[model samples]
Target: VKSLEDFYDMEGFRDKEFDKDDKGTWVVSSKIAIQKDDSSPLVSKNIYLFFNKNNNKATGKFVLSKIYEDFSKNTENEYRIAYSNNKIELLDNAPKEVELFLKDYKFLVEEKSFKSLNNLPKISSRHNDNLPLYSINYLIKQDNEINKWLQQKYKFMKQDAIMNIENSGELSNSSLSNFYFKVRYKGKKEEIQYFRESINFKPSKGGY
Candidate 1:
């Protein structure tokens, strides 16, 4: 069985320095299981490796993003994560070696009523026109390819597997749960092996 380390190696992540010439930014996200407070249940917290070009070298910082909690109680408590301004070098074409010390994230949430009393109004509307157009199309095409492969392998009727995937939220060990596993396993094994060696796969625990 493949582990999370294997998944990261397969993804081919590079330092933000080589990513874009104009934007000069790149971000990769991952989720880890953790408890928010003593009384709260464990939830997957989102973390990001954010990199941006700083002069000739790329600097990176580990950011602790927010989590979706208290959903059953119909309250969204915003978490404020604080981190130092310290950053590490992760430049492109440089020796892949760096040490970074991540401080423990501090979570803070103020009362909802307190915000309104202070004259801070929430902004609800956002401009969707600026969103990337290709991402939705790409996911749709991938889903179609996966569904096509599944139907051919299992003799599933049209739209049957698609329905199962949509309705199978958080159901582990089922067809929907194993969707990611299927994506990696769908391609030809020999071709994947050849490609993997070309990229120089080295498993490291840094930046994760």
Candidate 2:
């Protein structure tokens, strides 16, 4: 298996150029470009795929680092994937995984089954100081309610509640500590919340 360092140093990975100080945690671009009207524009996009080297897991922090509408004008537009931890959320559409889940398990859950849970309250605070104090009661209750509804409707085996936790490194300044969620269907053996200390969430009104 390739190491994380190898992945980071892979060919075609170029450091992103941004004006702001917050240049993202990790970013890289491709050398390919699209051409238009006698000019070779930087039309090709750069995608940053973040993964856990130790656990060999992927995260939702994938970003389109650079985009160009015209080669003559250096108008680079960056687009981000609507993210949760395990899911790649869309801007105006539901997540592809969620949609697949609905389609495959139509016998298990309806397409609109989770519509109500969609309105559940999200983590509103951006500071870790408020997480412990901030109530997850409503969120848990809502999830449980959905689980119960699914059980009643489909009579499928109900599994233990599984949650995604971001794990950070021991050193505060280590860039490798930037970890996100990994999905495991079996049990909560590795479900310990890791970076709950540094993370601050701004929950969306709808899906996040």
Candidate 3:
């Protein structure tokens, strides 16, 4: 198995700039500018990829990180179309073991299905905190009832519920909502975008 250190030292990444995190994980990043003509402005993009040495031998996938666009809004974008088909990069010089962890920082969850490789911590593990449980309840409720229940429960918990906890916007509704909760654990906190099929929600609670 190739270690992360070896990967960084590889030819492709040897010249790239990077930094180490507190956990010893490395973030390899780069900035690139492309220009087709002097008349057309240059297009610049920043690419980031995180590399963490796997502590376990089990194969896993990278958890979804930050998403930048609304695929629901730009359904016809050719880029979106390419990603949707997973025709992007299956033949890249990537390791099968690597396919288990650390998603390509350039791609979004909407572009591909990495569900089989996902290895996020369980949200229910921190039941004593009550926040995650409330979050589940919040996600489970139908109609606008989630707001009232969350408001009263949050007060009892002596804490205010924060929406878009991770700025993921995964928990938003068509209308404004007063009830929102943040899921925090082991000093890590974020409103993760749970898979819709994995959640227990009423299929036809409201008019579709």
Candidate 4:
């Protein structure tokens, strides 16, 4: 495997503007004007793709960062579709495990077969911090209800519950947007358009 320093010193990326993060991941940064036409006060984005070098292979499993500036409300969001093992992993500015778990959970609940899990997709974000302290009783009631529901389901529900505890958390709008972008980008890329049509890609909703 080629070391981080060695990979950065290689061709193409030798003089390219990039950074080595604390974890020694190579981050290639770039910016693109996302606005349509020569619109005034143009909106652009700073995109960063993190990679881990292994011999001649580079894994983009690290986060692909997208920072937008002065974006318009009417502008439709676009995302780059990641296929195979090149799928994005960490999302910037959040807990990596939580983000990945939520992303995969969304995929499992929405895209996977109905037999995957009963009532998994119905998980909602109705509970808020503003609730009264006495809500603890209702919270425990909720937990008992969930436990009963799981007990009535598959033998693997225990492990699933454990994994949820370890990896799940409140899904932020930005983190969720990162997942949306990776799965569906309506950009000028021909390959992306091809995949959108071939895969019959459509944006999903209401699976928090």
Question: Which candidate number would show the highest lDDT if scored against the true structure?
Answer: 2
- Given candidate 2, what's the lDDT at residue 116? 52
Clashing residue pairs in all predictions, respectively, total: 0, 0, 2, 1
**Comparison by TM-score, 1 against 4, better one:** 1
Off by over 4 Å in 2: 1-32, 54-57, 60-72, 82-208
Task: List, residue by residue over 84-108, the lDDT tens digit for candidate 3.
Answer: 1222222234445334322342322
Candidate 1 structure quality by residue, lDDT tens digits, 1-208: 1211222222232333333433232232323333334445543333333333232222333333333345564322222222224322223232221122223321111001112212322222222333311111111132354445434532323342211111111233321211111111122222110000001211132321
Angstrom error at residue 169, model 4: 33
Clashing pairs in 4: 79-185
C-alpha RMSD values across all candidates = 20.7, 20.2, 21.2, 21.2
Least accurate 10 contiguous residues by lDDT in model 2: 194-203
Q: What is the clash tally of candidate 3?
A: 2
> lDDT tens digits, residues 1-208, model 2?
1222233222221123322332132321112122332323323332233432233332332222223344345554333433233333333344453344323222111122335534554433232443222223223232365445444543322553332334332323333323332111222332111101122111121122
Global fold similarity of model 1 (TM-score): 0.22
lDDT accuracy of residue 62 in candidate 4: 24
Give the per-residue lDDT of model 4 (tens digit) for 42-93: 3433323333332332332222232334454334333432212423444234
Pick by TM-score: 1 or 3, better one: 1
TM per candidate = 0.22, 0.22, 0.19, 0.20
